[model samples]
Target: MNRTLYDLAGADPALRFSPFCWRTRMALAHKDLPVETIPWRFTEKERIAFSGQGLVPVLVDGERVLHDSWAIAEYLEETYPHCPSLFGGPEAQAVTRFVNAWTDAVLHPWVGRLVVRDILDVIRPEDRGYFRESREKRFGVTLEAFVAERETVLPEFRRALQPVRLVLRAQPFLAGEAPAYADYIVFGAFMWARGASAFRLLESDDPVHAWRERMLDLFDGLARRSPGHEV
Candidate 1:
């Protein structure tokens, strides 16, 4: 089957950084599915308008069109049952849902505070204005103000990963001994940071940092091979 993904890209087309898109990309790789990713940008909404919504990570699989990372993951699991499982089973899938929710609600916001401002540096010139204005309005402050004192808040960001830290301390991956959709969900946020900023979000000794290393090594260093900061 021919699979294509509209992945969010930076000023350099190879710099794919959207956290949500990373989720889909990792999920596809987990299933051993090959995909052709089209580099997409913030202002390129018309390019993906066919998906009924303007978002990168729009998936075109055969004749079917899918949007949303979670929806695409579920579709892949059901459509390609013979492939590697993203979620171990029904019970694990249920738990993974919680991870997804926590990532979107808690982790993403925390990550945005740290690296969202940096994204402007990586995106196209046309995108910078929209990015700054929209983000400022949503955040109720300028991007500079929003991420001001990031160093001071770095500890809080690390503290927010306490749950992940506890899990990774006992296991190599968030999904038991191996990677899964749950791990991908959280890993996407790190990928977002890695692609857009040089700022270090994790210390060397952190368990979550180790887990991210393991994830980057998966699929023969698939995520690691991408254009991103070594941090």
Candidate 2:
């Protein structure tokens, strides 16, 4: 245990990662804060109940349990005041919120749907049945039926990304010079889509692509001893 709030949340390393948590984890890494990761299953309401919510990425500091991703990010900033700005300045807040909303409110649902078909669709027949059954249990549907059914979420997802893609075309990071909590929160969802399955729509030269590569560099650039693990 790191003897912090982070440890109480994620005791298992492999299970500790979720994109939402990953964003903050990456941010903490960016700021060089020592954090412990807690992994919880989507179906495991006990974990949620423990934290008084049904979400992963809960941060457990010495005595505080921070739930929401953004709030946690802010807490880290305030707690570790020595680091440079993460949310950025006056106008930066708007841009930061914009990027976060675009990903969570828009791109994620679509990406989730696409991955089920594109990535989980590739699961072996027996495993596919189990995976789909599990998904349907959490999301709704039977394995045999879900694949046979068409996802209505597709069109809406593409429509949502339109503006987001437009924004990415203007700058590599949503916050401009470098990534902020805003870039990470949004990128967290995109990372899910990218890792789970391929995004055909992403190939169009949006700053989002550059941002992903940039994150990899940032993850690799620093030493683990200075802050947290690199990536």
Highest lDDT scorer: 1
User: How many steric overlaps does candidate 1 have?
Assistant: 0
lDDT of 2 by residue, 1-231 (tens): 252333211122232324576677777877877665544444455755767886656777777777777777778777767786677654765567666776676666666666555445333344455456667897676533544433554555556666655766776666666777776777676555544444343544545555666765676642121222222
Q: Compared with the true structure, what per-residue lDDT tens digits does model 1 show for residues 1-231? A: 789999999999999999999999999999999999999988889999999998779999999999999999999999999999999888999889999999999999999999999999999999999889888999999999989989999999999999999998898888998889999999999999999999999999998888889999999999999999998
Once model 2 is optimally superposed onto the true structure by TM-score, how far is the C-alpha of residue 100 displaced, in angstroms? 2.3
Give the runs in model 2 whose Cα sits over 4 Å from its true position.
Answer: 1-17, 117-159, 198-201, 204-206, 221-231
Q: Lowest-lDDT window of 10 residues in candidate 1?
A: 169-178
What do the candidate models score in CA lDDT, each in turn?
0.94, 0.58
TM-score of each: 0.98, 0.69
TM-score of 1: 0.98
